[model samples]
Target: MTSSQEQFVQKEIQKISLPSANTMRLLEINSNPEHCLQDVIDLVKLDSALTARTLRIVNSAAFCPLVPINSIDRAVSYLGEKMIVGIAVTESCGKILNQPLEGYESPAGDLWKHDLFTAFAAKEVARYAKNGMEADLAFTAGLLHDIGKPVLSKLLENASKTTIDALDHGEAKDYLAAEKLVSGVEHAEVGYQLAKYWQLPAPIAAAIRFHHNPSEAIEEFQPLVYAVHLGDIIAMMSGYSTGSDSLQYTLDSHYENFFTFSSNELTKIISDTETAFRPALESLAGKEEN
Candidate 1:
């Protein structure tokens, strides 16, 4: 990619819509330990769509709450701040992520499914890895990791067939390289720019930017990035709502050298992720129904 083309891609990214203000406020509350429960309820109530989505997800068969949750306040109180924020993040991006991206052969809702699976997988991997990494952070990184894909999809919609062929043929070293060759910018780079624009934490932004190539991530953020990368690969390997880019990228050998997980450990992580993903998959089905 040339410098001029890179500049053009950056300019296009600036034009992409961001998460809603209500969701942004919810994220802020989630990050602050001092925030009270009432703060979450008040903000959530401001967005009826968010309120309904939250209630539906909380009341889903997966959660299996002992008692029914009819109100946003009660739901927030029951699920606590972290879970609520996570839900808010997913809900806020649902419309954008759920859209079909013909460029990537992702039908409506497929990318969202892949994202949720990856998020849960990342959380499980972090738990098994036990590297003092926060599961919620890992989950967030995984969920938002591929956000740039949709943006690129839009660009590819009108791209020349030659460019699309290049992407499909593995002409470059890897998927990112292929993307860069054809589009002048890779999804990870675009995702990072969007993350910064959204004012997300540095670590999360770094993870999104470097998930496909964790070794390139800054030393301080490498572990988190590696966790997300592993989670993404595991999700793809397990055939969890994979998209056109599913097998296009190569797995980094450094992941094995860095984490040093035995075969049994890897199998256990995949199994645990599948268990966790079931409820999420069910919830998505429920969403489609409504």
Candidate 2:
């Protein structure tokens, strides 16, 4: 990104609200192993909406529990700590993420669907990566990877026609370059700033920053970055993607060598991602109904 774009991105970052205090507390509790299931239950009970959504998702068809989980305690015990935290973060950002991303040509809820799918894919990929990458962290990173698009969409509303046409026509080779050309900054960089402002973990922030270009990320974050990168690609391949730039991204050839999933393994990963994703989509849809 150019100096001017960097300045514009920083200014916009100031305008966006950070994640809620409850969300931050959940992140803290999940990050610390000392916190027990009761502690998470206590924190979640403080927010009625979080509790409701948690139980709703746990009992959704996607999970297919033998018995319906009615209480927060049962939900916590059934889904486990990591998934509870994931649900908290997702619900916290639902308001912002649920909007249409005009710049990316995504209709209402399209971006969120893509994000949710990527989150599931990332967690699955992390399990296969076996590179010390935590599934929860990977899920968080993938869920928020495209967060900057909403901000960019607002910025693009008043932008020049050339930039708008470029993105619309898919003229650029990739979305990142198109974003930089039009808005003076890319979505990944803006996402990085937003993550930092929200006080998210360093690795999560880094994964958002370099998800599209994993090679640029530092060595410490490479594994996590790779997980998100491949996850995003898998989401796109599985037909959940932002419009126009959906096919614009290039898959890193190195992933085949580094992650080394065989043909059958890759097929399983895709199938499992879809299976995990379906329930999440259904659960969220049910939430909308209520």
Candidate 3:
């Protein structure tokens, strides 16, 4: 990206609201390896709006509890950290995440569904990491990976077809390349800028920055970044794509250094992600409809 476009991304990022303090704290606590369920419960208890949302989701049709659970402790325990974080982050960032991206030809809610699907896929992929990885952290990183799209989408509004044409004629290698060619800024770089402004955890920031090109991430973060990368492609293949950009990025074979799942396992991962995504989508996005 040029200096002028970089300046524009920074300016647009400033207008985006930071996730609420409670949501930030919840993310921090959940990202920590030492954190337990009690930490999440305590944090959720401190935010009345979050607490109410938690209760409403837990009792919603998605979970189908034997009885309505009223206690915050039971609610948090039943939903688990992954779902809780999804609920909290959605409450804070739903507007931006759910916004229509006219530039991408993605209607309202497409980005949100894609991100949520990728999150579940990443979490499952993390489980097979050669070295131990936090599934929940992967889930969190995956959920926010595409956040820069909404900011850069406007710039692409008029250039979308031109960019796609470049891809068809091989004028640009892929969507990301076309994005830079057309708008002088790609969504990943824009998202990285926003991730820094939000003061998100380093792992997440790296995942957002390098998800499309995992090999470029720092050595320490490559595994987590690779998980999100694969998850992204899996989401697109499974039909949770964000409009025209779906399946447009290259997959790095270097991921073999971190994961050794067989072809069958990969298929299972995709299936499992689809199974998990629906309930999450309903729990996190369905409440508003009712």
User: Can you write out model 2's per-residue Cα lDDT over 186-244, one digit (the tens) per residue?
Assistant: 77877877888888877778888999889888888888888899999999998998765
TM-score of candidate 3 on Cα atoms, chains taken together: 0.96
The TM-score values for the models, in the order shown, are 0.81, 0.85, 0.96
Q: Write the per-residue lDDT of candidate 1 for residues 1-290, one digit (tens) a residue.
A: 67876676678677767788887776666445466779888998998887887788888767779988897888878756545666777666877778887666667878887887788788877775534666666777788888887777766564435454676675777667877777778888888878888887777788889999899998877777888998888888888553567766777777654466778988998898888777666764565235
Spell out the clash pairs found in candidate 3: none
Going through the candidates in order, what is the number of backbone clashes in each?
A: 0, 0, 0
Model 2 ranges off by over 4 Å: 1-11, 30-42, 61-64, 130-132, 158-173, 256-258, 287-290
Give the CA lDDT, 0 to 100, for residue 289 in model 2.
41
Strongest candidate by lDDT: 3
Q: TM-score ranking from best to worst?
A: 3, 2, 1
Global lDDT of each candidate:
0.75, 0.78, 0.91
Candidate order by lDDT, decreasing, is 3, 2, 1
Model 3 spans with C-alpha error above 4 angstroms: none
RMSD (CA, angstroms), candidate 2: 3.3
- What tens-digit string does per-residue lDDT give for candidate 3 at 1-290? 77888788888899999999998888788678898889999999999998999999999888889999999999989988899899988989999999999889999999999999999999999989998898988999999999999999988886778989989999888899989989998899999999889998888899999999899999988988999999999999999987878888898999999988999999999999988898889889865347
